[model samples]
Target: MSAAPEQAVAGRLSFLDRYLAVWILAAMALGLGLGRVVPGLGDALAEVTVTGVSLPIALGLLVMMYPVLAKVRYDRLDTVTRDRRLLLPSLLLNWIVGPALMFALAWLFLPDLPEYRTGLIIVGLARCIAMVIIWNDLACGDREAAAVLVALNSVFQVVAFSALGWFYLSVLPGWLGLEQSGEMGSHLLEQSRELGGVSVWEIARSVLIFLGIPLTAGYLTRRIGEKAKGRAWYESELIPRIGPFALYGLLFTIVILFALQGDAITSQPLDVARIALPLLVYFALMWAGSMALGRSVGLNYSRATTLAFTAAGNNFELAIAVAIATFGATSGQALAGVVGPLIEVPVLIGLVYVALYARRYFTTPAPLTEEDPAHA
Candidate 1:
């Protein structure tokens, strides 16, 4: 009855999504101004924390994450497993090719700045779980496949991110004959500076707090809403209203981050540019390559677009959280993670236009109904 989630997504870009760049910029400006003018405020906010994780950011993540996860039709994820042609290739690109590419690029580009390089490596390992859906929908991609990819990525990242990160941050650089940072030792889980030594539980606790809570909440919300209200009403009425709040939470989070760390950002303006260069290369390379991979594999435009977007985007929230946790919130490493969202919105929007233009070259797969001779 309700247009499938894919069709429903294409109606229009909501105002927040359309002009996210402006708001992000505004938030950064506000943060910078606050950091310079009212430093005390940010310092006070910084003091407010739970188990060394910043209180404001933790709340912000939950608020920003819930809506996107809620929109996902987890029940449809089984469809992805059925299409191994698309699924297997996507996994390879997302986990293997994607991480390897970014790691190589970061070292090649930023050899001198170990902290910044570490940040980029973290970004690469994080992969895309949340925002790829937005990019997929905007590109007129196969929403069902994108949703499954997101869910899979979520689970995969939680499991594999730390191990891969440890290898890259500690082991890979040594193998490559690069000098590793002393601060980034074999400490995979310990995060807090003042708490003496954070245990393994802290790592799981942070992941559970940031990801598990919102995911469970989102799934429950969707299941309950659909059961209580009919599909049409739930889709049209509920999603539209709840959707924009995520952006609001993100904007607020940016303000808090920049407000606290604006000095680091302003002192090293070139750091943003430096961090951005590899990301720019990574996003462009992945997007183009995934699209090509999809076409070579005989996927129609919708499925191809989904693969492209899911491959290209990174989970900036998780990257940011990890960066803040591993390195301090105001560290140069964390700054690069902050720079991610700032760059993602504009770049992905441009790529959306690129995808639309690219769509004409690819064929749409026939609908299931149309595929049958009887229907024809």
Candidate 2:
């Protein structure tokens, strides 16, 4: 299939594409309502043990992560690295620009609102993982660029997440007098602690368990299946069958997450809107900025969209896990993190369509080139 048609197919099947941002918003409302109405629900669910870890939320995340990791084609890594302009721009946007914009916005608009501010920062600091690939693919972006960006962001998040959290909560606020500028820096500080604990080991473990294991398993499974079934089986049947599981797993996780936090959502109805505004703005700004940067660097439409979507999305699963761990369930930081999916999925879907329409504007056919060396 051609890239455009394949993207359309992916979009047709993606729940993220179908609902736009509304599903995530609905999930937030559902989760908050569930959390508040049955106060013990999260507690009860939290106690359910899985391999000595009693965390239903974490388990849900683990399951959801599997399909995403499974879908990664490691062989494409080389191709990804060949495109240095795309890779560097993606990193700069995610690590430097994206986080900085989020911190500034949080400080500017939410200093008085500690939970909201912290939550916004947590969501912002997180880079894309699974969903960006889907968005890129759906937008007919350069697949290799998308893959490279995901790998790079995943590695960067490990090192930068903690420091960025600390800077936003501790240093930035004082420098900006976010204290006197808002509700008082104390609430911001208190919320910052909830958002910025350095649990590199915990995060590493989760990433390993959820992402690494599945990635290894998927690669092995693909290789084994290819050998057993031959080339035809690999191409015509296997990938298509397994590919959709990631989407299903994502939806199931979304449902449970919402169910767990439903009540809290119900009580604070407007919180979703409040949390979503900065995210919406961030997405637009990042996407536009990436496109402009890509054009300035003389990239084609596909590579530009790959960079744009990659920079625009967030890894909500990682953010949520970190938020819950640092802030506890009730903290606004956690709530803000939870609200990310609500905003991200739908907005990205719309962006996918927009990118499709915009492609013609940047349709300068470059030499069909090989993948990147770093990806190799």
Candidate 3:
């Protein structure tokens, strides 16, 4: 964070990274315009699916995830596992605090909009498994730590998502005496049944397709690349060529994702705003609080940033799928699910910058020996 390190970090960014916000905004606008103007765009995109996952979005996620995952020093992961300070807090924040906080905010912010409130709670229960890697990488977070924590989350998500959905949407509210609050309480059981209809196998399938493919590919790529060539050539020659694809993939995915819902987003401006407000507050508080907790527990800047991003991000793909399956594509709950990434993408990008700036306060850099995980 000294002027020298700050300047060095700034200098390290490529042109694409330097202007990431501009490219993302342009992608969003382009997607909205295309959706607004193009005929059958959504249907066309939807036609190409691999086991119910959108091909275009899947491609982008795979592309983005591979390079970052390949960058991890997989052998050094043992060090991360041994660090209870990092692992324990990550579990607590993602499973416990994250959902509970979102539940409170949904009730506090959208008291009358029961459907939207339910959607936000569902979003909270689905922890981050995909895009957190990109955010953490961009912020110079510890790649090994991010990988380990994300995998941990994926396991926990499969086990807990439905049960927690039941709790927050139905049981927890009743426990707090909100069961007699009229329509919201009366419909809790019905809503819980609808949300709970998404089976565990379905959620696990999502995790496998989205996270599993890229993770396996990334691991194989590193192993093969290093074996085919020496580690030096693999790192110095091949990585730079593949590195920019992550951004390209991100922009492509954004355009397609927003294009799919462009009409809804542009037409239902006020509704989008309503869904967005709680998401905004949720991301900000979760990221900042996680960062503070990480620092307090003696993590270095890289690990701390990794912790914050992973803690703050939600698996919107899962959330959207569950919402649509449970409540229909045209329902308010589904719309709330779509608006999640609409707000999350831009907000998280901004937080990456905030994290970089705040790195100055950490003072001492975390030691990274030859065995340590390097920045992705």
Candidate 4:
């Protein structure tokens, strides 16, 4: 698709797409209202657990994650080598710049609330793996590169998230003078110990269920469907219909969570917003930085969109699971993670529109030619 029409047309969000923010807001209202009225319901659902993860939220995470993962073009991963121009800057942004910026924002915004700050930093460490795929597709991004980056980021998260969460919550806060000693110091150490006490294996299990399962399913579905129905029809006819389910799952998850956390949220509206501040700042900063980086490097709009969304989006499910496990269900940290998707869905959707417009600023790179002296 030509970039202009793809974006102009992409701007025309469907009924669900257009009112997604409304739906999310409605979900939040409904959940918070339910929390006040039928607090028992959220409590009952929380009790229904397996493998230390909340069953309802776990189901939601699976539904939310699978469709996005299923769309990834794993077969195209090998071709990403030709995309070094995109890859080099992309790696630097997501791994290095993105994290650094998020860390700074979390600290800058949440100096008073260490638990929420820890939660935000944990999320910062886990880059967008699944949601970016959906956002990339919406913006007509380089889906192949999105898939490869998502895969690579997921692998990296499995090993790094827990370790970094420990480090950020433990050493950095004290080192930076953000945290103080005495009883508060003891409390900080306890939070760190609780977080550190979570074995990487526990997180690995969640990764297996949430990411590993869906990734495998996505691969198998692609392989089997292509064999049975052929690639063109599968891509053309089926993928579109299958994609909306991810959004549906996302909305449902929000409803249930807000119902659970609504009381806490209602009581301290400011605190909830406090946790959101760092996140909001992080998303805006990362998206702008990534767009600037991609444009400066002469990337095409598609690849640039991929990098921007990849840098801006995050793996909230994993972040949430780790938070709930490390802290109690009702902890501020868990609340910080729950609100992630509520804020994320709207922000990313808006950025998709913004990215489409921003595409014009960058010059698309000319293909390498054997006749060019630089190539020689």
Candidate 5:
């Protein structure tokens, strides 16, 4: 924790980690160019589907999440769970506040654009389970805390996604007389009719594929690695080897996503801008508010950073899959889903610097208990 050790750590970072933002931007540009120049490229990727989910995208997410989860000291997760200060605020932000905030922003900003609005709502409901680990780790968050929170979000996602979709898209909108706007109401009704209800089964399938596979892989890797070579070897030797893959996977996913949606994003600049506005506001507010809440509740820097990133990030993989499955790959809803990452990637990367800077404001958190694993 001294300056010399910190300096050594900084010096040890791979060129990739040090310039992650540059790589991500280059990937976006490359994907956009590929999609534009190569006819049928997006369709080709779309066709490479397994169980109705895009195979390429799924692989990227799994690869992206696996290493970070593997790095968690799973045995210490109870520390996070018993600390109600972290757990309660995280749940409140991710489950209750996040979805409602997005719904409000979507409606407020895109009242007449039913497809994009609905897409934003769906993004809000699918809480972050995959790429959030990357953001959290980059911001030097509590790894074990992130692991627990991501698991919690996955469970809540399966249980609550469909019901929330019903509420936001159909039930609550009507209750608020949002449907009274004649033509827009009729358009939304027709859109809803076309899409049917958000399928619980599909959402569950996504959670299983995206979270379950990597989580299982990570747990077994740690268990087997530690049992064979001991924790020291696993941590000091193995973790560094695998750690870079998380960012690699992230960059790969970005390229594929932008490629698939390049034409839509390029042609409909104004629509993308409309969707991006709400999303920008949503990410900024959620992250800043969660950080403030964490500091107010006396959390240290790490858990507070974890809370902010997890609350700010959405499971865009799930959101996009659902949009394509329900609304067709080319629909405005799917376009909005694509735009989620466009805004999120650079913004969250910027917020990582903001978080490291803000760390000075948080006092050292008290120990979880006498036997706090972190302190030990």
Candidate 6:
């Protein structure tokens, strides 16, 4: 028999759950092409004025994040205590191993390329927000576990990003090359000019304006929907309606970003290729490292995949916003951040399949319980 409407919707998303990375990649390519052909498209869209306020590409990011954040079952947080196995691996991979290795690779491969180097760090520092949950769901991961990790990671990024940026830009350059070290301060100063004299406070305001407002609106909407009807109605009716809009908004924003940067990308086609190498290496290393840690800690296959994919993916939206604020939309740092989704999507999609098939090898039989008496 055919499934119910909700079941049909769920089943449709099942394909998306498995192949989301593909969609992201397709979006990236389409955006890149549109960007090259029609410069100023992104900027024009970004300037979409409503009541004297211009909506930037960042707004699209905020909109896209709504569905994911709204679905976060915050109440379930208490029910979901941390699994040290999952937590430690994720922490080590994201903060310690992932960033360190990415910095080293970027330095080695992109010597003297300051803007690209900064972009590499941006990718490495930001943890995945959207796709990680999709990955976890696809892998049959513990939903509560994924939600808790996302919340914790989001908190950590706020604290760590600035410090990590300073370390990578200020400290690491000296170790990488004396010439690069000497130019580090100057490069940062020049990059800062790309902000067109925008203050950090102004950037923070934009973040609040974009991310905060939408998030608040989404939460309020969800709440009202829930109170008026119940969790079932909210999930069944409201989420489905809102969810697709978020994706469409995301794609539209990406198109705009590409349109704005199309000329730059066309002029420097090789730059994208150069940036992709280190990121490719970084993704693979983090993925492998997460899996190993998960095994060492004795996590189940589903939980292990969750930890692995979470560690591997980059929160490009946050990176792009920070890049634009710090280095302007035209800066190489911003371009590098833009390059992240291009490479990340396809690679992650492949990993999803690998995780699905590899589960057989990783899965362990349930431990026998004394009360069951099956062994006895």
**How many backbone clashes does every candidate have?**
0, 32, 0, 0, 0, 3
- Model 3 misplacement above 4 A: 8-13, 180-188, 366-376
> How well does each candidate superpose onto the true structure, as a TM-score?
0.77, 0.80, 0.94, 0.85, 0.92, 0.75
242-325 in candidate 6: lDDT tens per residue?
665555555665565565566666678799899989989988888877877787788877677778888898877667777876
Cα lDDT of all candidates, in order? 0.72, 0.68, 0.85, 0.73, 0.84, 0.66
> What is the alpha-carbon RMSD of candidate 4 to the true structure?
6.3
RMSD, each candidate, Å?
6.6, 5.5, 2.8, 6.3, 3.9, 7.2
Over the full model, what C-alpha lDDT does candidate 1 score relative to the true structure?
A: 0.72
Error (Å) of candidate 1 at residue 168 is: 2.0
Candidate 3 lDDT tens digits, 5-85: 455555666677668899999999999888878887876876788777888888888888888888787888999999999
**Least lDDT summed over 10 consecutive residues: which range in candidate 6?**
367-376
lDDT of 4 by residue, 339-375 (tens): 7776787788788667656655656522222111111
Reference-based lDDT, residue 292, model 6: 73
Off by over 4 Å in 6: 1-25, 46-56, 130-141, 175-228, 231-250, 364-376
Best by lDDT: 3
Task: Look at candidate 3 and tell me the lDDT of residue 96.
Answer: 98
Of candidate 1, the 10-residue stretch with the lowest lDDT total is 367-376
Q: Give the TM-score of candidate 1.
A: 0.77
Summarize candidate 5's per-residue lDDT along 134-186 as a digit string, tens digits. Answer: 88887778989998898899888888877777777877888888873677667
Instruction: State the lDDT of candidate 1 residue by residue for 1-376, as single tens digits.
Output: 1235324443355556656657767887888788768757767877888877778877876787777677767788777679988989889999999999989998899887767777788788878765565556545677668767766776676567767876776666678777554655434223322122223465456557766787789889889999999767867888777877777876777787677666666677787888889889988999999999999999988888889989888877667667776687777678888777667756886787688667667767323221111101
Instruction: Give candidate 3's TM-score.
Output: 0.94
Quick one: ranking by lDDT, best first? 3, 5, 4, 1, 2, 6
